[model samples]
Target: MMKIAVIGTGYVGLSTGVCLAEIGHHVTCIDIDINKINLLQLGNSPIYEPGMEQLLTKNIENGKLLFSTTHKEGLQGVEVIILAVGTPQGENGAADLTILQQAAKDIADYLHNNPIIVIKSTVPVGTNDSIKEMLEDHCKKEILIVSNPEFLRQGSAIYDTMNPDRIIIGSYKKEASEKIQKMYSPLNAPVLITSVRSAEMIKYASNAFLANKISYINFIANLCEQVGANVDEVSMGIGKDKRIGNAFLQAGIGYGGSCFPKDVKALLHTSLQFGLNASLLEETIAINDSQQELLVVKALQRFGSLNEKKVALLGLAFKPETDDMREAPSIKIAKQLTKMGAEVAAYDPAAIDNAKKILGDIISYTQSIKDAIKNADAIFIVTEWKEIKNIELSSVLKEAKLPIIFDGRNCLNKTKIMECDSIEYYSIGRPAIIKK
Candidate 1:
């Protein structure tokens, strides 16, 4: 088994650490946050990924997984080091690689042997080569630098890592590629070996393309509304074609979360740096940024005077099964409602704590889905959580002062919502469902 050390216990690093250990490799996940390390040492996950905590507990018990806050202490005798640090978006649209550069220096300073250093973060092209040079400057001995960008989704990280569609191994050195491939050899997934530059471009391009699909469908959905057409039906029709396929085609509020928004912008800036005009991505970002304000516009049209009106904001996080709200539409929707003098009560399964840090006492946070919608004048379903999707509209009407819903995610079924005569429902890509 490859003794691996994964740095930065954020969403990607933590998931990779646990999945690597589960595959029979002895792995240690290190982070700078002492509080997070304390929690992980006690078998609790700082970030919420499905099936991570239980798997982390099992791996710790079996002596395959370990946690630490110090890189110097964590790298002793580790044959391979994976840098899974954050590449946050800088002020000018490029990905800030400050953390990644520091991680490379730390690995070089503490290395006991000539171990392979893998870049698991989604970095810009040529970053791996720069890391190799940085390491050589710090260490007397030569070290191998490999680019192995991760494609794990936030919610289904474990499943995606264990059963990846394809594993990308980008290395300049053949020996370095072989060593990294052996680390994930147990999974038996198809591994693609390419140049380091290609691998870096692959990560940025893959995410940028997915972001394009979302914005394209949303633009189409808006056009469908204008033409009295249904986007859901249109999406289904186009999805049947072999070329289009059916992924990232769901028409709703624009893309958010950690990867799509930032990566697409990063790719755009990278292209610009090379004097290339990336118009499609530039428009994609513009559309997504405007999409966040869509629900507020609709709400204002439906109710001109929102002063003293109670609006229930459902789903705080950008998506379901995770508590990350980096670019969630709910952020804008809640602030807009409050700006218009409307009372906002919000509920999310996992992101409430994080939301509180950003939202503060401006809006009231509720305990249950029913509580968020109850006693409210209007409802805005921003997230597609399973709990919110399965809620009874009749029960909502009985509890709420008014039975009006604006489904941003289109979570509620239109046909079923139409069965009730007292409810006024509005969703994406379809005509508003109103009571006679």
Candidate 2:
């Protein structure tokens, strides 16, 4: 088993380290946050991901997983160092490399043993090469750099990592490529070895394309509403074709979470930097921005104004099964509701604490779906959490003051809503059931 050191203890780093250790590798995950390191040492995951804490506790008990705040301590005797630091969006939508640059500098101090530097962070094209240059310049030795970008969903990161569709290893050196291949050999997934730049581009290209699919479907969803065509049926019809997979065909309040939004903007920034026409990406982002506000527009159109109306929002996190609220559509929706003088009460099985930080006391936080919707004039389904999706319409009609609902994610069944004659149901790209 290989000894590996992973920098940063965020979602990507922690998930990668835990899964690697699960596959029988000795892994030390280092983070600058002392609290995160301490919590991890006690077998607690700082982030919420399915089956992460179990694997983390298991690996730690098996002596396969480790955590530290210092790079020197974590880097000692490690054969591979995976850089999974955050590259948040900076000015003009380009990826900010300040944190990554600092990590490289810190890693350079402990590179006495030649270790393969694997970049598991999602970066722009040619970033791996630039990092290689920086590391070599700092250490004054030739270092092998491998661009091994991660393709993890926020909610199912552990499953995605362990059961990856394909592992793309990008490195010029045959030794570096083979070493990364050997590291992940236990997974038995298909491996694609390519140039570093191409590998870096692959990550952005893949995420942007998924974002494009989301925007494309949302674009069609808007048309379906105008033409009285059901988006669900249209999505299913188009998705049946093998060439057009049904992955991101769900027409919702645009694509959110950490990956799709940032990657699309970063790629658009890259295209503009190279003097290329990227109007499609531009429009993709434009469609998403408008989609986020679609529910609010509907609410305003329905009530004429949201002056002190008690509006209950179901689901605050970007998606289900995770507490990640970065770039979540609920943020915009909450702010708009509050601005329009709506008393917003939001409920999420997870992400309430995180949402409170961003939302503050502007809106009330509810413990359950029933608590959020009780006595509300209107209800808006933001995230399609199972808890929110399984909410009984009978209870809603009994509890709500207005029994009017706007589903942003299309979580409820239209057929069920049609069966109920007293309730009003509105959803994205679907005909509204306004039988009150």
Candidate 3:
């Protein structure tokens, strides 16, 4: 088994380190956060991901996984170093690589042998080269840098890592590429080796394209509503054509979480630096940003004004099975609804703690769906969690006073929802069922 060090303990690092260990690699995850390292020492995960903590606990018990608070501890005796530090968005929309740069310098100081440095974090193009140049001044040996961008989803990151769509290894040297290729050989997936720049661009391009599809479908859904057409049917009809496969075609409040929003903005920033006007990418972001307010517009039309209206928000996290609220539509909607003098009762099974940090003292937190919907005039469906989707409309109507339901994710069954005469159902790209 190859010895490796993953330098970061966020969603990307923890998941990567644990998965590599599960695949028979001896991995030591390094982070600057002592609290995070202590939590990992106790076989616990700081982030929410399906099947993540279990794998972490199992791998730790099997002596395959290790955690540390410094690179000096984790990098020693390791042959491969995967840089997975945070590249948070800056004020000007560019990816702030302060943490990544710090990690690279630290690795250079702590390296015991010449090793392959894999860029697993989502970064701007040419960041791999930048890291190499920075490392060269500090290290005496020839350092091999590989742009191995990870494409794991937030909720199912473990499953996605274990079963990746494609494994990309971007390296300048042939020896570096082959060595990195052999490292991931056990995955047995389709591996693509290319230049460093292409690999870095691939991550941004892929996220931008996925975000484009969501915006495209949402725009179509809005048109469908205006023209009395169904977007679900349209998506199904078009998806049958192999050229336009129906992934990310769900008509909703738009894409959010860590990847799409950050990557799109970072790419736009990069384009601006080169004097390239990326009009399509700019419009894609505009469409998504506007989707957050569409539900409020629908509510405004139905109620005239949201003055002291009790509103129930079914989901707080951006999506289901994840507690990540970064750029979540629910936060925007909650703030908007509250600004309009509406009382919002927000609830999410997993993200309540994280949501509490953002929506503190603004919206009331609810423990159950019944509590959230109790005496509510309007209910806004945000995330399509199984618990929220399985909520009975009739039961909800009993607790709600007026029972005007705004289905943001189209989570509920329309047929069953329509049968409830006491409830009013409104969803994106679908015909509204108004209770007369």
TM-score of every candidate: 0.98, 0.98, 0.99
Instruction: Tell me how far the alpha carbon of residue 123 in candidate 3 is from the true structure, in angstroms, after superposition.
Output: 1.0
Pairs that collide in candidate 3 are none
lDDT of 1: 0.90
Which candidate model has the greater lDDT, 1 or 2? 2
Per-residue CA lDDT of candidate 2, range 306-393, in tens?
9899999999999999998999999999999999889999999999999999999999999999999999999999999987888899
Whole-model lDDT per candidate: 0.90, 0.93, 0.92
lDDT accuracy of residue 228 in candidate 3? 95
Off by over 4 Å in 2: none
Residue ranges of candidate 1 with Cα displaced over 4 Å: none
Give the Cα-based TM-score of candidate 2 against the true structure.
Answer: 0.98
Q: Give per-residue CA lDDT, model 3, range 1-436, as digits (tens).
A: 7999999989889888999999999999999899989999998889999998899999999999999986787788888999998899999999999999998988888765888899998999989998998888788667799999999899999999899999999999999999888888888989999999999999999999999999999999999999999999999998888998988899999989999999999999999999998999999999999998999999999999998999999999999999999999999999999999999998899999999898898999989999999999999999999988999877887899887899999889977876876678899999998775
Number of clashing pairs per prediction, in order = 0, 0, 0
What is the C-alpha lDDT profile of model 1 across 1-436, one tens digit per residue?
Answer: 9889999999889999999999999998888889999999899998988999999999999999999888877888899999999999999999999999888776777776787888999999999988888788778668788999999988899999999999999988899999888889999999999999999999999999999999999999899999999999999998999999988888898878999989999999989999997999999999998888888788788988889999999999989999998988888888888998999999999999989988888999999978988889899989999989998878887889899888998878777787887888888888888894
Cα RMSD of all models vs. native, in order, equals: 1.1, 1.0, 0.9
Clashing residue pairs in candidate 2 (N, C-alpha, C atoms within 3 angstroms)? none
Candidate 3's C-alpha runs over 4 A off are: none
Rank ordering of all candidates by lDDT, starting from the highest:
2, 3, 1
Candidate 1, poorest ten consecutive residues by summed lDDT: 104-113
